[model samples]
Target: MNEFELIQNIFKASVMANTQGRKDILLGIGDDCAQVQVPQGQSLVFSMDTLVEGRHFPFDADPVDIGYRAVATCVSDLAAMGAKPAFFTLGLTIPKSDPQWLAGLAQGMAELAEPIGLTLLGGDTTKGPLTLTLQVHGYVEVRQTPLRSNAKVGDDVYVTGLLGDAAAAVPIVTGEVLVSNERLDYFYDRYWRPTPRLIVGMALKRVVNAMMDISDGLAQDIQHILKASNVGARLEADRVPISAELRQWQPESALSLALTGGDDYELCFTASKEQASEIQLITQTLSLPCTKVGEVASEGFSIEGYDGDISGWQHF
Candidate 1:
């Protein structure tokens, strides 16, 4: 089928199925530009992520997994800023229109978007190498949204959820390593379907001084906050959270992965010392593990005990 037909039969149908109960999206698919009404006393926050085949995912990756993860990883930006997810637009390019693939991709995205209250507003489909660019829109309270540049000296540093699993999964997904079924399942799930920590972000919004999602490795991603906030950090290497599965799989490499591996999607943030008890209470209420890895320093970044490279995922 042609591009327009494919969008109507596959993508538009997916949008209709997933966007139910969303009143914020005033105009959606089939428009030249989608429209939404901004809520009072709130600001619009959006981010775009581009995922290329083979580079971002396995060439043979399932379309559904790709779709789900595309949304998950992109919406993670919103979560970092303590924004509530609202709408997203897709920009899909493929060499050919495969009905089944399109359907799976759409289904995968819809599943993730539904629970998070994200609606499909609009997008473009074109013929080319397989690439998906998703732009997600969220709303945040004006002046209340935490920023990467807001970190202050003496602020406690924290990260939500375990790190390094997604990085470890790369070798397994690419068939470069052999692993047990348990290991395979755990790592695969971590890579393909990471939870976007939206609730945690919202809960910590008022508490955190500076925040950003770990897209690149902590070694690299944390630098952005440090530079932006004009502060430095000294992370305790042992404090970085590693999953039991990863430690069991590769004890020696687990620390490296947790330190320098990418795609964790967990929040790496800083908060004042006074908010420590409240942060603990929030994490307990949410039943999510939030680890205090270090504290913001006056100058210079250092991770004690890890004397290796910190080059995270580089697009170049």
Candidate 2:
């Protein structure tokens, strides 16, 4: 298919990509450029992420997972800033115009977009090796958005949801792991389809002193917070949450994954001691597992009981 045909047929024509009659979108696909309206009294939040075959995922990974993951990761950034998902544009490159793959990608993205009320704005398509880039835009109350640098000393460090499942899934995806069962399926799904903590982040924005999502890994990602806030941290290794499935699948390696494994897509935040009860109430009310793992300190970073080798995910 030609470029225009691919855009109209695979993307613009898909029900998932078109948000019919959306008042906020002045123009979407089929236009020279997409246009949108920022709501009054709200600040716009935007993030872009690129995924390349072999670098970001296995070359033969499911196309649907690829589509879903691209959007999910972009929205995760919005969640970190405590913003609502609004609209997104896609820049997709493929070696050839494959209808089956495009259909699968559209289906996967639509399933995710429909639930979150995300509208596909517009973007570019090119003939090249497979790579996907998505730019997500959202909004939050003016001047209330959280940042990684806002962590304060005396703040209790917390994380929403378990960690390390996605990191462990890497070996499975690469065929390095021999195990197969519920544990394998769970990890595989976690890596492919991460649950962005949007609601939890939006709820905790006004309450937390600092906030960020766990994309690179707990140890490395948390350093961004510490350096930005100009403070240190001492995390209780025992308090770090690990899933039972991961523990059973990798008894010796699970702890390290939970600590340094990337791709959890969960939110890590800090609040003062006085707000601990309120934090608990918020998580409990939402039925989301929020764990207190450490506190912001005035010195250097340390995770008690973990002194072994662990590093963050790096493109280099």
Candidate 3:
């Protein structure tokens, strides 16, 4: 199909699916740009992420997984700010019009959006190297938005859920791992479909002094918080959680991956020692697992139980 036809068929349909029940959406697809209404007394939070084939995923990766990951990555940003997802726009660039590929991609994105209450408002389509960009917007109560700069010395650093599974799954997705079907499925799912800690973020609002999602590995993400808060940390390497799947493969490597491999969309935040009981109670009520991995300090960042300097994923 030609570019215009592809837009009318696949792009339009996806937009329609995304904008359904979105009362705040004033304008959607088939327009120069989409429009939305921002309610008063609420602050709008926006984040965008782009995924390119080969660079972000395998060249022959499943489109559905690609779509889901693209949206989840952006939603994670909202979660970090303790905001409720409102709507999103998708920009897709592809070399050709492939109906099957587009359908899978739309389905993947819709699956995540349906449960998260995210509406796809609008986006643009073009011919180029295959890439998917999602811009998500959320809202938080006035003056209640979580920031990474609020952490104070003596605050307890906490993380939710297991880490490093996504990074471990990367090799499985790229055919680097030779394992049983069960193990392969475990890793592949972790890498492709990550659960953003939206509920945790929302519940921690006002309680957490600083927060961010662990996308670029825990070590690196923690540094972001430390720098913003103008404080250092002493992370207990033994306190980092590693999944059973990862442990089975290489017990020693699990900690390294969990700390430095990246791609885990878990929530990491700082709360005062006085707030620890309250945070624990909240996690129990929500049925989410959380662990105190470190303590905020007035000095430099360092991790216990590991030799030399701390290491994590680097974009460069």
Which lDDT values do the candidates have, in the order given? 0.90, 0.86, 0.86
Query: What would the TM-score be for candidate 2 when compared with the true structure?
Result: 0.96
Q: Give model 3's TM-score versus the native structure.
A: 0.96
TM-score of 1: 0.97
Clashes of each: 0, 0, 1
Tell me the lDDT of candidate 3.
0.86
- State which candidate has the highest TM-score: 1
Candidate 1 lDDT tens digits, 1-316: 7667766678667645666556666776766887788887889999999999999998889989999999999999999999999888888899888889889998999889988888778778888999999999999989889999999999999999999999999988878899889888889899999999999999999999999999999999999999999999999999999999889889999999998899889999999999999999999999999999999999999999899898799988
Per-residue lDDT for 134-243 in model 3, tens only?
Answer: 89999898899889998899999999999989988887899876888999888889989999889989999879999999988888899988998889999999998888
Model 1 residue runs over 4 Å out of place are 1-3, 18-21
Which digits, one per residue and each the tens of the lDDT, describe model 2 over residues 1-316? 6656865577655534557767778777776997887888888889989998988888877888888888888899999999999898888898988788888887778767768878778888888999999999998998889989989999999999999899999988878886768667787789999988889888999899999999989988999999999999999988999998888878998889998889899999999999999899999999999999999999799999898665788858
**Which window of 10 residues has the lowest lDDT sum in candidate 2?**
10-19
- Error (Å) of candidate 2 at residue 194 is 0.5
TM for every model, in the order presented, reads 0.97, 0.96, 0.96
Q: With candidate 1 superimposed using the best TM-score fit, by how many Å does residue 15's alpha carbon deviate from the native?
A: 3.7
Looking at model 1, the pairs that clash are none
Better of 2 and 3 by TM-score: 2
